[model samples]
Target: MQTAAAVTQKKLKRNVSLAFFAAAVVFSLWYINFSFSEFIGGIPIFMNFLFTDFLPPKASDLPTYFGPVLDTLAYGVVATVLASVIGLVFGFLMARQTTPHPVIRTVMRGFISLLRNIPFLVWASILVVIFGVGSMPGIFSLILFGSGFLARVYAEAIEEIDSHATEALDAMGAGYLQKIKHAIIPQFVPGYISWTLFMFELSIRASAILGLVGAGGIGSQIKLTMDLFQYNRTSTVICILIVMILVIEFMTKRIRERLI
Candidate 1:
């Protein structure tokens, strides 16, 4: 049904977009001082450091890391739950259909965007200065980061819901609260759960390094070990982090598969 001119124009637009994407990649590499030759030259040295210094992970240190690692897991779980609750409220405000006013929606969108743009490390640093070096800063950092991301995801999921359901409720003389309770909440549950699980997985990884900024977690252990040239202990910590991440990823994938 499409005309030849339309097809040609579409192809031209696609090519232009690809060109711009390639240009952006090149620019980013240059801006970051990425060098293929340097990377190749450093491969041997990197391998030597990895094998000689970090090899034979100190299994004995496993017991030492248990407490901090548990702290990291707790941070991830608590942050994920807090963020989901906050994001759920903000998400309704962000969604086009659910938002009460255009101005409020726009403002909420901008605030969420700002939260997403700022790195968790930056948040941790600022909060650490305010809260004074503890798990509180790290927890708040994950909450801020996860809430912003999940809000956007939740907004999109809300937007994609079948409009007819809301319309039918409206026709039935349903109040806004009733319509949302019956229609939106039911439809958004699966997507919200999936996104929440994904965010929890990410928070686990983030919490691991949060301690380096004095926010408290396994990252402090990593930093301390590295500073003392105790690479073997650091390697053990790294292994635990890798295993934790892998397990979370696997569990989330299976859960999502079942839910979705």
Candidate 2:
């Protein structure tokens, strides 16, 4: 009887805690001036803006946008390629059995962590200051972010693999390179490719935003159009970006399925 009473009390306490949390969220929304009534009231204004400013999507500007679109694609591709290569090397070093030294592993891991934790926008903004507002800054930002991300993924993938092949090679007096070539490479290649493909998708999206900071791409075009109140052109650019992403995603998805 005593235990039953305690259980009831615990459930009531939990329910009360959840009720307070819900109330707090409601209060926060009110404090921030977030109201469904306001949104409903603004619908007519939103529709006016949409029809007056965003319709017919600046189709004539599509030709001029080609260069920036290509630049975005190039940034994503080059950064992903470079980052994958660098990340693969570092990832091997991060693995327990593969690292040349424990100290080196620790340092390499710390560097990868730093790269991944820092936002690409922050990287691009800083690089733009140094590189003077070009695709170079955008590419470098993607490279840094992609390398860190790929290295972490690759390292984890490496750690989870069956060690029997590598162990046999080691027992047969195989050198590190030989073991990597004969055993580790075969097993890790699929995951490496899959991760790299995923990173390419991420890099494309990230590179688009890099242009907002003057690191050239379609984002720069969008920013320019918005500054001039050309939301129609901005909408067109976004449409192209959406199509590009969809195509890339489709291609990468097929490739990943095949590889994995």
Q: Pick the candidate with the highest TM-score.
A: 2
| Model 2 misplaced stretches (Cα beyond 4 Å) | 1-6, 9-13
What lDDT score is found at residue 157 in candidate 1? 94
Alpha-carbon deviation at 178 in model 1, angstroms: 0.5
TM-score between candidate 2 and the true structure: 0.90
Residues 27-97, candidate 2: write the lDDT tens digits. Answer: 99989999899899999999998889987698986899888888888888899999999999999999887
Clashing pairs for model 1 are none
lDDT scores in order: 0.92, 0.89
Top of the candidates by lDDT? 1
**lDDT, candidate 1, 1-260, per-residue tens:** 99999999999999999999999999999999999999999999999999999988999758888899889988889999999999999999999989989899999999999999999999999999999988899999999988999999999999999999999999989998898899899999999989999999989889767878978888888888999999988899889989999999999999999987
In lDDT terms, how accurate is model 2?
0.89
What TM-score do all the candidates reach, one by one?
Answer: 0.86, 0.90
Where does model 1 exceed 4 Å of error?
1-38
